[model samples]
Target chain A: MIHSDLIRRLPASMKLAAALAVVLLVTAACGGGSSSGGGDTAGAAGLEGKTVNFVGYGKDNPWGAYFNGVFVPKLESQGVKVVDLTTMDPGTAVTNFNQAISNKPDLIVAALLDTSSTVVPIKKAKQAGIPVLVFDGRPDPSVDADVMQVLSDSEALGTAAAQNLVEGLKAQGRNSGNLIAITGTKSGFAAQDRMKGFDAELAKTPEYKVVDIQDGNWDPTLSGKIATQLFAKYGCSGIQGAYGMADYQALPIVAAAKQAGCPVGGKTGLVVTGSNCFKVGIDAIKAGTLYGTATEDPGTIAEQTADYVIRYFNQQNPPAKELVKEERVTAENVAQFAEQCSKA
Target chain B: MNVMSAPPRSDAPIRRPGRSRSRAELVIDAVLLLAVLAAIVLALTTHRFATVANAKAILTSASLVGIAALGLTLITIGGSAVSLAISPSVAAVGMIFLSAQSFGLVPALALAVLCGILITGVQGAIVGYAAANPVVLTIAASFAITGIATGVSGGSTVSPTGGGYDRLNATPGGVALSVYVLIGLALIVQWTLRRTGFGRSLYLIGENRRAARAAGLPVGRTTAVAWLAAGALFAVTAAFTAAFNTSANVNLGGTLTFDAIAAVLAGGTPIAGGRGSALRTLAGAVLIAAASDILLLRGSSTGVQILVKGVIVLVVVVLVHLRTEGSRA
Candidate 1:
């Protein structure tokens, strides 16, 4: 009986050791953080002739123009050729990416507005022996291992906006009042996260009363419409400030408030702030229309994505993920960033 | 006259529960009433739901949607509930107005209406003459129009950089103006349906097509005219939407189709044909807006809101179907 017990324990101990060794090896591999593929560039240095194609949304918007015009130039200065197959229509653009992958480019970079729509294309790209790098959008968990993604701590964008609003209120010496939040399309991930972030931060302060939240569908007209009525109903009383999801949204809120003859800009105006660094929002900040706005640097994201594609091409160890930082652009620094953006 | 008799029935059930809905034969009326109730309830219960601000917002958002619903009402009552690609047609036409806003607001708006009328008339003529399936025909027309809009705008939103266009959209009483436009459209459509002989012919053809054919009704001409009217209405709505949004994109009228269709169905327009009123559709549109607004105020997610709407639409459609069949049986 003793001999049999020893035999059973020996096999169990060996199995446990083997599992522990596998986990330890993975931990070591992941913990060792040199994205240069552990200096494996000896053979990859000759990858100068490779081409990486990129497809994204908002192809004709100002964001796209900067990415294509300025960021592409930055990457090309490093000897990487970038091909664009981009469009604004979510469905159509995803299809374009699917077709682009069939040709098997060296690498592909895509920014899917909605993660759900891009799954098929991303999966197909990965399966077809092409490495796909996604930026500015979340990825589905099932498909996460297939492609690498770059994201921002957007929740922080929300908290920062809320903090700015709180400070503005404090500057006005507000102990109690209503604050309305105007959100982008209610279903969008960014809209929900940003709203939650702002809401969570605002909750920390007891005196500020959050009255209502409405979805503006990220349309200026809709935001203006919502703001117009909110101003007329509440006037400059009760409501101390407002939070908008994006600059596009902030423009309308400002317009509606201005139309209603409500005090705006500076400390006296409705304290408005948002995420997404559109030129209009930065201008709004400088003009004292918006209190604060978050900047993601789309051009930087584009440039970084370009760099990532280059890394994959060079067979350098790719980082599992990358997170870009967003800074709150207020009246203090709106001019500086605005100048750079305008130049782009 | 005796020879033009109702078709013989083959042992159909005389009546069914939830059938014979004469009280709500007009779906639009019920939809309208429901919408009004929803708005009142939403505004009352939800914080800041019924505030003047929300009302203004609702009206502003509803302006173009309300106008588009009016056009759809005309088409539905014209004996065929079809748009002939009215949505995208108007969106494309409105771009021209937006592009030419430097001239003046009145002229820009007028040109947009004209463009819309022409596009719809052409479509009406083709669909009328071909006698094609409205679904397939309108789908093709939509695709073509969307392509054109994309080509014209280069798949981007084109804002009125500066001009009367901005002034018109930003006019302080923009909401009121939109409401007045909707009222005027309703009155005009009501007058056409009730006062004109062509209107009676429309109902006649819708109720009994073969009988109307025997009575020598100009069915094709009526459909063409109705479609043209819809096109014109859609054009105005598109212009308003573009002006209000301060931009025009390829998906300008994308959301209107579902809204318009929902309003029409909820208002009690029988899909089988020939029984609805402008009043009913107006109410339906309001109700749809009110429902969405209520959900929005409740802080519901977009997905949940859409799901609720889908369920409501499904239930209403089933009821409408049952009522239609029960009335006949």
Candidate 2:
């Protein structure tokens, strides 16, 4: 009541100016609150007209395709102009990242091929007062340059793969048998973590011995070759189950096994499981050639990464590190993930 | 100086002093004998190395590299040095095949081969007519091919819409179709190298380009034909690889160039050219494959396999160098 009376007593011009000032103050308060509250579309206004530089890797592979397909469009839809510096080569990726830092965009988003190679440039970006958002690979915990990171639970995915393998074996009416692990390049962090998790989980089941572990190098052709050699070395009856680090790798094993005259996928046949929930794996699962697979869907991780980017810009302060959840997909639950996996 | 009269000797059978050729052949034979003895020792020592399944595995794995090496042998013989573009070309052709599969299998395969021909044909024309460095030209071609493939495919894996071509992966009579293809191609290529005028011209041109040019030989054309033949074989390798994987990507056959080169070198083909055979490349591919399989069976790491292959290449290179030096002396 007092505020209204004061306005009424003022001259007409003074009253108009005072009312305008109050309106502007209220608008500012609302916008600030909305941005801080982490409202989905609320903070997008802040990103308008800003530029982001994206340094990525493996633009040719499925995981990279899915992530780039989703993430770039989302940011662009909010009026964020993106500069793409994606490359498949590790050395080239570092050069691109440094170039991105020099561009000094409003933000720097990167998915480095190797963290060790980019630590120096990331520090430079930090010193420049530019925020960095990392995805696909987590930076070293000691590094303070990265504002936040969104990564797949690769170790958990590996554990899920082991669980699926065991379940597939049980479903095939076997409690004890020999198994082979066809993994990606042994030096890769993802491959190593997956194997570590696989070993930790498989240790609980002592009867199932890992007779051999060969590096497939994440190559389908090499994996197929390794599968053939493994089949020859182990014989059709000697091994009962197999684990492929990815669905593409697992599918080749299925083909190789068929060529080797080894029965696969039936109750009495060999049990095969893969990870990475690729469409090929989903299709094979539907076709009954693949026993099971674990979900490390690139699309899901990408979406979360996008959300974190939005949150960061809005000053909502997303967590320093986020590990996306992973699950195992088998015949029983394959239908639920079929659509997403197909997209991946 | 009558160009034709300057080298009447060029038309009378292109020979390399006879002794050097025979010594090289003898060294190749010794290498083959050593490979055989090693295989026998592995079979006796290893538990499952002697099985038919194991033999099939080795041959099946070797066939891919064997086919590519066979074509590479022609290039090496024609004095073009080695091509570093084989892997990229194979990958590009595989992508082309998968993309064109909607128009029946044979048409897609033909299109793929034509694309491969066009790709290497340009490189051949440059190397043959312009006398460009084969290694540098092929390296540049690899970059261009990889870039184009990535852009055209949008850096995604290409999968066939239909399954009609899966029969290409079939094993007939307990032998892989790829092995049969490799053997058939090797025989045809070997026969052509022995009987054709083009083959004789290649040998003459490779041994002494100046003499062949003075005698009015088609040096440039023969070199180009060698490259074209290699491209066609590379296309065949791509087809089999894509059919086996049921998908094609830019990374397809990533290690193929190195493997193919290794096969050519191990086959006892002199890098200086003028002599070699497709059958030798096949044998070399088989030996390498068998060695890899044996190592794998014995639980060796990939590093060890690579190290052993490096050692084999080093030994073969040194042995060839010694023989050539000895013969010259």
Best by lDDT: 2
Tens-digit per-residue lDDT, A131-160, candidate 2:
677887667555743556787888987888
Q: Second chain of candidate 1: TM-score?
A: 0.83
User: How high is each candidate's TM-score?
Assistant: 0.75, 0.87
User: What is the iRMSD of the candidate numbered 2?
Assistant: 1.5
* Winning candidate number (TM-score): 2
After aligning candidate 1 to the native by TM-score, how far in Å is the CA of A103 from where it should be?
3.4
Pairs that collide, model 2: none
lDDT by residue (tens digit), candidate 1, B96-178: 77787887888888888888888777777765556667777788988788877765565545556445765544544535456
Residues A290-334 of candidate 1 have per-residue lDDT tens digits of 888887657666767666666665668669688777777777777
Taking chain B only, the TM-score of every model is: 0.83, 0.89
Q: What is the DockQ of candidate 2?
A: 0.38
TM (chain A) per model: 0.80, 0.84
